[model samples]
Target: MSDVSTRVDIALLGIRGGSTPVHRRSGAGPSDDGHVLIGGFGAALPIRSDSPYSLAGNKLLLDGADIGMEIEPIGRPKFYDLQTADGVSYEKIAKLHGSNVLATTVVQTCIRYGEDERCRFCSIEASLAAGSTIAVKRPDQLAEVAEAAVRLDGVTQLVMTTGTSAAKDRGARHLARCVRAVKAVVPQLPIQVQCEPPGDLATISELREAGADAIGIHVESLDDDVRRQWMPGKATVPMSEYRAAWAEAVRVFGRNQVSTYLLVGLGEDPDELASGAAELIDMGVYPFVVPFRPLGGTLAVDVDHASAPNRDVLEDVTRRVAKELQHAGMLGSDQRAGCAACGACSVLSSAGG
Candidate 1:
């Protein structure tokens, strides 16, 4: 299949999850990275199989018809079986995302988890309730687990994301500590840290100094009205704050090193989303456009608003944003670390962005 068609297929798979898909039994959650190697590229896609597609052996079937493609789900890594010296399981602390990237929710609880304040699509705390992950992961524990992952799994990078803490730094401080500890143990491992835009832009520099190679200051949406509807609490931060944070992060982490997630399936207009992506590219921020999966624990799933965007809508928005990325010479692969670089959750890379 061509790149556009492949991207379209991937987008559809995310919307309508395939059945009997290959994946490891033990990995990250409440939102796990269901890695499936698709097409001939061995491109690892992070899928949440909640939709109508399925697999028969290696062939991918969409709505029971052959997709005319082969896919293989990634198996759980050996490192998950190991435990820390203190007896905490490695898998509880962090899990492999995609094929080789170790990822963790450094702090699983968010301040905005309340009904009126929470992002409708977020499942950060749900994993904790499910006993799939711990509430707080110490810096030292993260360092220890990361070393094991690198040594045992040949893991190339790290993604450390945290829910918004009560502190004004929005958990950047804790993320920095975790990054420092991990970098100290494995100096060559590239690390990506994710958090909300800090109240003090200076924290961006602190994260860089602490050894984070890339940063994800995810806004999820650029349309303020949509933000208010889907993320009432986060929307209060305002677009200006996000812009300032992006500018500061770009200044500290350098051009393509800063990325943000712009979820496409929300109610944002396609033209507006694409335009926002263009503006983000101009600011040296990579807009990681992702299909909005209706995770089971999210408010969207409960309200019956979890439908994925139409195929045409997904493809149009992605192609437009990909064009912007290409024109700006901002390939997601250039990040070297983080969600944008992973390319499993989004098809912009396949679209030649």
Candidate 2:
């Protein structure tokens, strides 16, 4: 076996950098300490005190020995130092993701965050609770912060996700409002709008018409059992709704422009997960396969003591899904903008998926 540890290998095993300057201490689902750029691309790795991999002055190390890859941590953006006209910090509005994408939760509070109803792996409101973010980000606030982020940090894209709202649009209409405001200020910046499917399918078209370049209708897992177990509240939305949303999103945003998250550590069988990813690819949806990292404030960590997936399984599924993406000519980089395009939280891009 090669001693030069693969980037994905390091990502799975994680790194012991207790002093990491740019770690995200709290956030929503998917990942935290989210931006470690290896080979000039973003990677999501855990911050473990006992990890085999460590970062030493931009050099990657395995078991205290230096490897050749240059892994750079994305620092706090310049815009974070500034505040809005009403005196809210710019960071509370949106945060830097990867090297070039600005990300935020437009509506930080979730209707599904009740103890019995919440997604086991989510902590969408943790940042809000910690006073690092606001309950709602207004359209003007988003536009102002976006313009500054791009002008100051050279950000190339924006990703806006919202907690599921009680309303019929499920926050899509609000996403459109924020998107339109940002587009009015920065027409050249590609924007990706993410939300649960609305009760009305027409809002999918409204998002595209509002200057959104891409959309992520994330269902996380296609397996109904997995959905039911991991996402009790969201699972109630029915697979039929997700299917309708994906179809409508594909119709509106076009192929390779639509994506979804498929977490590898959710206990879905590796072969089966890849099989599901292949199906998504066939349907013109990019399956973003990322390993689940346990985060503070999530039920998985606080209640179940869930560790990340077995690394072998993570790698196996990634390669399998990447092959399918290759066969379909659907590269994450092909998308105009979104999680797939930034690809910090998933290994699919590293696997060349």
Candidate 3:
């Protein structure tokens, strides 16, 4: 544990922080660990005035000077070049997330995206604003993209998430249909569906019956105050509701297959965060603790909000929760699909699982 702490500190010191042109330029390059280092200039290069973009000439160093892990780039997926029969691009329907998961936002618009209710940390519509995807992805369109991604990119799994629709089921109905459509083509592909707790508990079973291998009902933070502040609209649903939804999801998806996102830097006490994570573990849910990176164009970025939990906080919480998970025999690999299965964005998987 002490060694892990020291390594985290070294990594933190090397973090350049913020999304300036230079900082963004120095952004994540792939590492041999099967995940990209979230921050730091990819490799050290001299600041040449003539060619700012070139980092190739510089020597790669880690912990500011000592050599550490080598950085690589995530290769582009082969499906990028393919188009559906109707002329819609495969990349427009479902794109590669991390290294192997094909992910899509079934509906590009969210009910909470209005000024008053948007998650302060989310840039959910930024990709849409940039014309990176269409507004609503049809079932057929998703099926087409999934088939191509699998055949061309060697994509091993699928993730379907949606912005909260106005309907009571919060878009689970559409997600179920999308899952069914994709399964028709790729019958054995593992699929994970993410959404808010739906109005009807039956929707949980609906997703499983539709061929979803896993589900993520992300309660970004367990603390009520943090939720109210960071996710004002989503917080209206209440924690009790999230708890009930998670219970039903576990019953349907089976234990470790259900997961949630636990954002660590949201001002919650470390003990409280760990306690909540422990509770989720007891309930057979994998709590994915991700550092809050201020994505471009979110309200959080407007206020210059940053992740509060440093590497120490992240390591402490992860170590404690991981111990409990191990005691329960709940390794992340036990999960059939989703972000927890990919295990790239969070270091908890590296800590133990």
Q: Which candidate has the top score in lDDT? A: 2
Ranking by TM-score: 2, 1, 3
TM-score of 1: 0.92
For candidate 2, lDDT tens digit of each residue in 208-301? 9999999998888888888888899999999899888988899889999999898888888777888988988998999988788777689989
CA-only RMSD, every prediction: 2.8, 1.5, 5.7
Prediction 3 TM-score vs. true: 0.85
Instruction: Give all candidates' CA lDDT scores.
Output: 0.81, 0.86, 0.73
- Poorest 10 consecutive residues by lDDT, candidate 1: 20-29
**lDDT value, residue 60 of candidate 1:** 71
Which parts of model 1 are misplaced by more than 4 Å?
Answer: 1-3, 13-33, 39-52, 63-66
Error of 3 at 269 (Å): 0.6
Candidate 3 C-alpha error for residue 17, in Å? 14
- lDDT by residue (11-95, candidate 3, tens digit) is 3333332211211121111111122322321221112232212122122243245243334334567888888888878777776
For each candidate, how many residue pairs have backbone atoms clashing (under 3 Å)?
A: 5, 0, 1
> Which pairs, if any, clash in model 1?
18-53, 18-54, 19-53, 19-54, 22-73
Highest TM-score among the candidates is held by which one?
2
